[model samples]
Target chain A: MTQVIISPAKANSMYWLGRYTERVYLELHLLRICFDFMIDGKPEEYNRYLASIGNTFLYPDLAAIRSGLVHDKNNPVSVLACVEMANDNAILLRDEIMSPTLGYIQMSLEYLRHAAAESKEPDLDELQKLTDWMLAFWGSIEERVYDERVKNFLRLGKLIEHLDMNIRFSYKFYRIEEAFTSLLKCYDFEPRAFSGDALEDLKKLITEQEYDPRDPVYVNKVLLLLGKVVIL
Target chain B: MQSLIKNRDSVNRWMERYGVRFGVYKNGVFNEQLFPFDSIPRIIEKEDWKVLEKGLIQRVKALNAFLWDIYHDKHIIADGVVPEEFVYASKGYMPECEKVDPTGKVYSHISGIDLVEGKDGRWFILEDNLRIPSGASYPMIAREITRKVSPITFVENHVADNRDYATILKEMMDDMNGGRGINVILTPGRYNSAFFEHSYLAEKTGAVLAFPGDMTVEDDIVWYTGLFNEKIRVGAIYRRISDEYLDPLAFESSSLLGVPNLFQAYKKGTVAVINGFGNGVADDKGIYYFVPKMIRYYLDEEPILHNAPTYLPYFKEDYDYILENISRLVIKDVSEAGGYGVVFGRDLSLEKLSELKELIIHQPRRWIAQEVIDFKDLEILESNEKVERKADLRAFVVSSGKDVKVWKSGLTRFSRNPDSFVVNSSQGGGFKDTWIMD
Candidate 1:
């Protein structure tokens, strides 16, 4: 357990790893919620779910968006893109995170690639598989990562992104509080100077703000502050 | 052999799942394609390996001594065993590396010596890749999966276990730990051609797989910085990057991939740079012609291995021979590598041959011509059938802690194109494992 010096480049990469894993993990959650819509002949239902995740263009319709998420290599928010990025960062952290721990991420990416090559539609079954892998990745992060500081950094990213997604989709009040609490726990392990004021502000907002899904200005500000809260 | 061939596809599938691919960049686009594995292995008999092991060890010892000598005293050059001008004129020779000695005076800790078996069944040394040699990990990882795919093959054959490459590499790095800090494999980035080997070796050796940006020099020592701001001192860097890009200040000032003042840390003996900074002089194409002389000069021994029938245009007699037999020889530019800058005379048109002759005559020291050896071809699986392909072996020799050891396995690269003799992975060549019979 050599002391981990999070170089600027690696910190930046891990920050993105956190965001991308959460993006894949949670986006698939959104897709799973919308999957039944597409399959039950209620594509508009799927379109509304897509809108909630900030997808502006619903044109070219259900099949395209459904397949695009899992199949498109260029899709910035695609599951394939997110999983690939997560695995790439994991490669950088090969010493910090073992390969058997990264096995889940690798399998998930390989599955997505195979489905794309086979021209399989993005369906509930594939979504479930991705969900399982993402969960396993988080589990591995907790159980397998050697150094506590390394785990803390990854968890910091994961928690920040979890908070960002929670705010973006306006999850239930209890879910927001739970994610916020988890982020606080992970950020405490970091031995650097971070904003206690910012954390306190965000905590106050979470506890006191009126529940409104449409008024995301305050939520966006909190997200910005969350990005800044981790100092490095 | 039959069962191994039958299960080749499954082995390859496992390889794919394990990301056993090489990266190539062309026209500014990077593509990672699998380094296809052929089922038919190139087997080396124990008796043959006995001779090869001795030769490889002797050759590398000579090469390492040559590197150390070239950097410190000029005994070999001053004695006129090798011309001083020829030694200094090589682009691989670094003037900044003068008088710097690594731990145990081992410059090439790991050496990839390329050899070919002639039709007469005698092996001829083709190349010495002292500067940042690769491909050991290819066979190491491939054999792991192949063994799993067909365990019966190993149970029957008296093959030496190849899985000890990682252990050997770790011991080498650990023994060469000059600063007693962490050992790291410094790669330029994932986009480099051999990134897979870099990452895989790091994983196998438990060394930190560090990018150029992930490390920095402080107080004349190298340090590995992790994602949580924890910094560990790095004693030995098994650098996969090229020499020119090693340190921006000492070599290519424009190379951001290199750490600033890292060469100074190495110079101060605060770090051990495996396959030391100025090894190119020993493995230089022009200098390769002088290896036998080096063996005689340094070790007072006769050369056990034979270099190919080679002609250096820099010499008067060799130049006359090259000029006379321009159509029957293979000319290689000393500066070019990875199957590039190699031209067989028969493959050249009459006009091209004449142009090459002019280039050789004017820049005589730039090229070396060799008589083409009709090397024995090995049959490989091609579309479920056996096809004979030209292949060469790259045997890894590691000098660790005052001793040199050659691995029992090697990477056997073969040409994918039927008419071509180029067998570099960068040139779309495929590879198979080399089994040393126990």
Candidate 2:
């Protein structure tokens, strides 16, 4: 088989497509959990979710919070916005990724727009479909994309985003460790893209015995280290 | 066929799921809209296709010969078969490519010849698009989805398979490459009007889809730039960009969408540019008037295809005739394309007709008047109702180093409006697959 060569722009687009799709998927999952908590009489759950994602703006009510997080076009962290960004990047990689693979992103964008237009409050079922489409999108990517290097770049973006989101949500140490391990496997495909010193520092921080999820300074340090791992 | 028509909705939905769309700019904002597919196919009988196939191959071969002569020996001009003024004064005539020769002397490797069938069972050539002709992918993908939606329709009808277009394209590119390096389809980015076709064709042909800055030239050789500064030599490029925006250092200095010195690589014979440079001169509307003469001069044979009755105002007799019969003719400005700069004399008021007459008299070489043939209309599905609409067929011809071959199927575009004859995608028209009977 002939070697598949990817240009810089295509590689960048593929990486970002992976990252943004993961962002949309994980954000909706977290939002659904927080929404359940709010429904169970914990009104402060929305504020806690916002703080976890590092978003500063607060919604006026539960309805406002759901709309802002799911359908707000102006909100950079909104599910709709992330879907659009993933689509924008996927559009540029259609030749490499194939149309059927790109179709999932297009479907998700169309579904989000249609659902938002139909209701003021975010429909949980429709949001569930968006998450399903993201899963299908990744599935299509795995089945359709042929180049191993292209898959590696996209997988790297996905693993890194998963690690970042798990760290932000203060997940269990095992989950963070699993995400980082998955990322390290993909990072081995293109180690030149990662900073060696930062990789070493992140390895040390994650392997530490007292790696507490509730410690703010330690979490900040891990996040900082994670940010420095990828050198664009 | 009935089953296909009944499942038009499913076919269109499949088209949407695959993101089959074309980009258009309205009021300075770019929007990507789905190229609506009508399930009702335009069926061509095998006997009719046989004649069309012969005519198209003959025409493309003659056109290639004309380009070679015009750029090198100028024998057609020397013999006065084609007017010197029409050849030299054409906007597509480039002095920079006067002596440059492309691989295998194949200038128009791919030709999209637009034709409209008349009510009298005659096909009249409307235009020849030798430079970056689109709409092939629309029909190619439409057939894919339509067959999926209604396999029984394909089974019942003995229609020729239209799926070999990508293979034909690949073979042509390989013929031009001559085992140099990898093949790439260079696109002007995703915002271009035909970006979907660009990407789709790249995927189908197994060619790399390259954007503007994805390539660079060094020492008269073109190379694709990888993320880590790795360079892979490009053997052939099926460039979708216009000649003006192909190379910044050679043609348009201000073009950011062109690779600098890429033209130098082409001129040095280090790279093969499909549908080679300086091909616009042959496809100009004014130059279209002499294509029949070109067939005779170059091929030593009578044209199997017929040109629409066209009169160039550059000649005294034709000029007087156009002025005398202004209301019955359609005047076209040779410089504009995509259904623009076309004026029906019947639609213009008396004042506008007078102004057009003056413009034609002052700049006779810039215009051509054709007797509008009442082309046969094809039936299209509109809101669950079958309606008659004006449609034209765009047959694609591929010229490799070996021979010229015409694809069995064509892109049949129809005007959605009842009163309109323009069938371009940019003008909000829809498309139907052309099924050539086996």
Instruction: Tell me how each candidate scores on DockQ against the true complex.
Output: 0.45, 0.63
TM-scores for chain A over all candidates = 0.86, 0.93
On DockQ, the leading prediction is: 2
Worst 10 residues of 2 chain B by lDDT: B12-21
Q: In model 1, which regions exceed 4 Å deviation?
A: A1-4, A40-44, A117-119, A139-143, A191-194, A208-214, B225-230
Runs off by more than 4 Å, candidate 2? A1-3, A54-59, A208-210
- With a 3 Å backbone cut-off (N, CA, C), the pairs that clash in candidate 2 are none
The 10-residue segment of model 1 chain A with minimum total lDDT is A1-10
TM of each candidate vs. truth: 0.94, 0.97
For the second chain of model 2, what is the TM-score against the true structure's chain B? 0.99
| Candidate 2 similarity to native, TM-score | 0.97
Candidate 2 lDDT tens digits, A38-140? 7876857757778887665577877887888888767888888898999899998877888888889988887777767775688787578888888999898
List model 1 lDDT by residue over B262-289, tens digit each: 8999989888898789888888898889
